[model samples]
Target: MIIPFIIIALISLMIHVMEPVKEIVLDRLNGKITYPKTFIDKEHRTIEFDSLHVYRTLTTSGDFAITGKKIFIKDRKFNYTWTLKSNECLEYWSFMVWYMDKNRPLPLGTAFNEYRLQDFERRKAEGFSKPLFPGTFHTPERTPSQHRQRKEIGGW
Candidate 1:
């Protein structure tokens, strides 16, 4: 009887842990959940996240530069840095969609357009700018500084 109870307990524990894991697997399979792929454009000072349904971009200065199919900056700034929440990015995309087209669906890569330029100009006129430390967003891999320092010490 004790051995049977121990077996049952192990099975119960496994089920409990695997329930969530199974749900996650199903969600991923159904496209209900997605992993984000981040792209950093050091020359443009922009970071982009592509999470299947939604695409987002921000300047190093924390400005919501682009989200989904909308652009928030008329002219790109290379010397800015900041962080933003995913929800904030989604909200910006929704707002731009509503503002641009109420009835039509936003096309892929819709963020690159004259309308975005106009919107960015309007926002700039309203003086909406957030500046943060450039070092706030660092690449996961080795940076130029690391390379430069190592090179200086002849420690390739």
Candidate 2:
């Protein structure tokens, strides 16, 4: 009985700790930026790039609320809207817009940087790399000053 209780407790703790890892995995799997003829979501639903719509609204706190919608063309037509209400929303939205634009490179801070640490670090080092749109998003990585110092010291 005690052994079972201990196992349950450990499982619960592991689940709690794995929450962020699970989210990251889902984001990576679902948020892939591609300009294929058709876009496939994590739910296995498919929609054309031209048919998809991306919208941005202002939140009460003056931040942005980016949302996307698509109309399915199956026997039963339906509308699917997706809103990423997480810290990675900015990056995801950037990728989405870039994909829609056929993968043309957007401005440094306006783009997702394609998971390149150097681009991210350079953006931080330069500082003031604000997004073209207004949003209250944050990437909780190394400090701007630290990155700037690293750049000054010939670090990549």
Candidate 3:
């Protein structure tokens, strides 16, 4: 019993210590260097975007590609086709959307920061103040009752 308690305590301590390190690593990997018209990724690869496309350096041989598109309002998924490989990619995607659109709310699961807080206020002023987490005040729209009712009514 004492050995089990010690093991659990060690595991908890390790997790507590590693959580911040993981967050720091993620922040660096996902962070970008911004300019007036473009930004650079973690590998110092330049990325530029317009309304329709994200142009980025894709190869070490200096080839560039349209790697992604600007996110539109009401897009709930980070990558609709589940193509992105990691959370770092998702963070980059979220940052791209954040950079491109000033009137939209922060993407879901994004942690609040000073810049994002300011943007949230700006978006709220523009009447796009949806909370990042659903069901904050009440049950979400797709609760079990709603699901059952929709099934009963043969709704999609």
Candidate 4:
């Protein structure tokens, strides 16, 4: 009857009103200043020999803590451990590596951007972790105003 419709519509409205906003505030109080863009240092990077065939050319600026001597690359098509050290990696930025299926350098996959911390009790409840290989990385030179804010301790 009309009564059911009215109840349903009212319930739907209430639910919509209670739903969270489109943007969640990441309250990071730390005064950390990251680069305006995400750029990898190609000059100080090296790809492991026979590192990738379907996916060739891996580069880094040495920022990860590779205690296992190297990284372990595993994907739907390729799998290999890396021997990169923190000293050899990039300094300030975190990294995301992904595998490609061709004999050339493909863009980072979904993992690079689909990073989400499962825990809610952590310091920051918002923002996702960087994917291993993002489909593409943005740089200050590439897109200017897209990313010009200083990232805080919580999220950037």
Cα lDDT tens digits for candidate 2, 36-152: 122333333444444445665434433544343322222112354544565566567655444333212233452455654654455545553433333343333344764465445
**lDDT (10s digit) by residue, model 1, range 1-156:** 699999999999986765421111113112222112223332222222212223345444347544333323221223332322445665554443333331121223546454544433443343432311122222111236533543444322
The best-first sequence of candidates by TM-score reads 2, 3, 4, 1
**Candidate 2 Cα deviation (angstroms), residue 135:** 17
Q: Rate residue 124 of model 3 by lDDT.
A: 40
The global C-alpha lDDT for each of the candidates, from Candidate 1 onward, is: 0.34, 0.42, 0.37, 0.30
Global CA lDDT of candidate 1, please? 0.34
Ranking by lDDT: 2, 3, 1, 4
> Evaluated with TM-score, which candidate comes out highest?
2
Task: Write one digit per residue (lDDT tens) for candidate 4, span 114-149.
Answer: 321222112123332332234444422112232222
Among residues 3 or more apart in sequence or in different chains, the pairs in candidate 2 whose N, CA or C atoms overlap within 3 Å are none
**Residue 36, candidate 4: C-alpha displacement in angstroms:** 24
Q: For every model shown, what is its TM-score relative to the native structure?
A: 0.16, 0.28, 0.25, 0.21
The runs of at least 3 residues in candidate 3 whose Cα sits more than 4 Å from the true structure, single-residue gaps closed, are: 1-48, 51-91, 107-111, 115-117, 129-156
Model 4: runs farther than 4 Å from truth? 25-156
Model 1 compared with the native: what TM-score? 0.16
